[model samples]
Target: MKRIKFLYLVIGLTIFLGCSKEEITSIGQQGDYITNFDFPTIEIFAPAKVGLTNRSKNADKFLWEFSGAKTITPQGDTISYSQSEKMVPDSAFYELPGEYNVKLTTWKDGEQKEITKKIVVEKQQPVIVVPENIGVFLEVTFAARVFQFPGRPVSYEWDFGPAGTSTAANPKVTFTTEGPQLVKLTVNDGDETLSTEVVIIVQGELAKTIYFTDAFTRRIYKYKLTTQSESQVEWIGATTGYNAFGLSVKGNKLYLSETGFGTRFSAGDAAIADGVLKSYNLDGSGENIITKPVAASLDYRDDPWMHTVDRFGNIWWTCRNWGVRVINASSSEAAYPAIKFNINATIAGEGVSTYFASDIKEVGNEIWVSYAGTTGKGIYKYGYDGNYIGKFTTAIQSHAIRTFVVDQVNSHIYFATNRADAGHGLGIYRADMDGSNIISVDTHWSMNIGSGGYSDQGAAGEYVYITNMDIDVDEDGKGYLYYGYRAISDIYGSGNPPTLGPSAANSGVKRYNLDGSETASFLFKGYAPYGLAIDQVKR
Candidate 1:
């Protein structure tokens, strides 16, 4: 009975101790609590007094209010809060000039934070300050110089106090007559404006000027020849045209053959059929058409193509269907048949087409005609009586031949042979007036010479000038020959070929010496300037 009582007492004690420990654990778990938490700080990188927007990231909520605003509201990252008293971006574009302060309050998770910043709205207009010293001179054409501060003013206006007109910006203006003139210039940006003036004294004549005339813009500019100042020379309209193919001058008269304007053509016939041959004075005055009113035919196959003029002032030309014709120097309207070669009847079965007549020279009583047929290549001679004086044949098919005064002091007839496919460089040959004792000095293709047979066009020389065709000799007795060389781009184009322009490899007029040395060239303005004539006029 005593043992049983002890067991009961021990068991009771253990149960009581376990109950007390459970109570303590429950109190400790309930004590883990938090209160009065502060919100996280915010750092703003924007300027102070700025028009603020809620740009905070990862925030649950926001309570925003500006310093001077009447009401406060909940704002988020997407919500922007603005105040009428607060300045906005671009609001004072050209008005206000300085910076301001602004404040923002953000609230998230029952916590509130405030931010402060400064902002500045810039004016669009610039500040312009004109320079004080402006240089002046005696002549109205004197250079008008002005300076400006900041160098980037939006607008500038210039007034040259005399009858002279007003211009804008930094400009150079010349006066017509000489005297003291007040020059004024105004500069402005949207925000600021400034003005500057200077007294100018100009002297000297404003007459006699240089000018330039392009094909499209026919405005002739007149620039003072003394100081290279330019002005308007002439105003040409639809009445004035351009002729790229034909240009010749006699005395003070200039003749040009025009082939209509624009690129409208059908089978070589311009819409305004029959091209015009017009004449004008050297000073761009007294313009009139000398050719007959009947539309001048652009018939290269049948009619006469005026190639060049001779020393005697006679216009010598050739017709494909007919023969050669001569125009009197005094009257261009009068044309007479000087000689007609009976090629069709004389050659019979041989295919012949008179491409062009080479240069003509009158030796003694006979006129030498360097004629080349399409099939038979040779130099044909004709007497003053229109009688054929036989021919001298070259090895290759000849297209054209030019005669140069070879040693006029020695009276030797030197002609250059234009063979079609033989080679580059000139086939230099010398013959008598009757075409005898033919000697060939093959130049061979040098770096100075172009390639192939189509290259040899014309040659010119004094005593030492001998090329396939054209040759010009300097005082050193060396010969420079001018030849027509077609490039790969020439045969496939419609307009002017690249080989005929200023950047051509072998275009324009070429110059060489007697021993085939010191070759140079000059770019001719016209396209394919096949005909070249140099004569001394009584300027």
Candidate 2:
């Protein structure tokens, strides 16, 4: 049995040796190209591509083997991967950061040569830190703050508060609600992934508001000071004959003088020629229910241009041609015209019968008046009893004043004249409280002081407002100051001199900065805004 096993093994060895010697002599005769077993040295950063450049010498076919097949694509070389080329390309890129043993086998004439190379992919791990809570407004967008390892050539995904999302690096986002919101940011660089979360505080729209009167459309418009939204004042179409000429607010009550020439004082024309002085609560309750009547009383006619309420609840208003008139107002019964001031009483023996006050406002204990007449036209001061105190324009050219605005903290009185043509006194001026130190502040005047080609000014404030009759209402609602006059395309008919009440696209107020630079224009839309007032109720 031992001799038989030995004989079989000896025969098997003899056969393999004979075949090997035959194959070697045949390959030597055939001039096979498989000679070098070498590869190029490769060094690169992690997660980047690797090149399997063919630099072998005298090779007919090549095979590559990459270990740890899980992290690599086209995992390992197969039996059919022997390509007929000296330089062999890789199947896919390497994505993991670790040393890999790559085996290369070259074949020519069925003779094979093999080599191995150690590829070290260096590591790059970045740290990410998400920010804290960021406050954002629900109506206004907020630019997000982010701090992360930069220059990584990474892709990002952002989940902004619940459902909002963005791909921008520094994204401006508006949240849906007002509260603490959650945000998530995820970053990835090939095989590396990182993410973080933060809270964001979102603010909501405004609740309280500011009001304006549209004299032409017989309505009042309100602007939400906090949210920057504008709409009409309440009790508008609810009550007829609600034309507002000038507006004043005191303790939840909005007072308006809505009288001018050739105007129907109604939403439906049920007025008595001229407009009426009326009041409405902040929520638009109590329209002309128990206040100053819409009729002439105490020998003073019922034509008031603008009105103001004193601390005593008395109404001091401009009575058109009848100077200043005071009315005892109440929420109880219809009030009567109390005191009338046709201050014909001479100052330095000059009777000022042409002294017709066009607008009035109360600052502190005294009431200030802006008038437009042939004589004694300036910002005039008066006591609570309708007695004339002094004239402010006496320090400058005293003529043709229209609106009065008193800034108590600065002791400066701002007023605008009714004339807009050449040589007319400044369309707007500022002066000391005691009728001195007169200085012009308006920057748009001279050729056409007011738009619509008329010579009269309207609402003025820290942002001065100008009333226009149907000027650029449908377009941008803006007008420019050209040659010192507000230049907007005239909306009135040819040869028609402008009037106090205008129709159509209505009016807009241009807000001018203190340096006379124009800031913004808020259109009144459906109404002609003649006068402006602010409600001091804190919200």
Q: What CA RMSD would candidate 2 show?
A: 24.2
Q: Give one digit per residue, the lDDT tens place, for model 1 in 170-205.
A: 445645545566766666655477666766555444
- In angstroms, the error of model 2 at 201 is 15
* Tens digits of lDDT, candidate 2, 1-539: 11110010101011244445442111222443543333223344444454454445555566667674222335543222323232344332444457877777777657898877776655443322333343234333333322223355656677775547777665556554657777777767555676767675554343444566653444665554343333344534423243245677788787766654322112222323344567787666677733443453322234566788889987777764556677655544455454466643454356667655566777777787765555656666678876767655355336566566655544555566665323444456656766566656554443342544423332111111232111111123232221112222222211111334334343445443333355434333434455566665433
Spell out the clash pairs found in candidate 2. Answer: 54-87, 220-233, 241-266, 392-435, 445-484
| Candidate 2 off by > 4 Å | 1-208, 227-243, 260-274, 289-301, 332-335, 344-349, 420-426, 432-506, 515-527
Q: What is the overall TM-score of model 2 with all chains considered together?
A: 0.49
TM-score, predicted candidate 1 vs. hidden true structure = 0.38
Q: Per-model C-alpha lDDT, please?
A: 0.37, 0.50
How far does residue 412 in candidate 2 sit from its true spot (Å)? Answer: 2.3
Best candidate per lDDT, number? 2
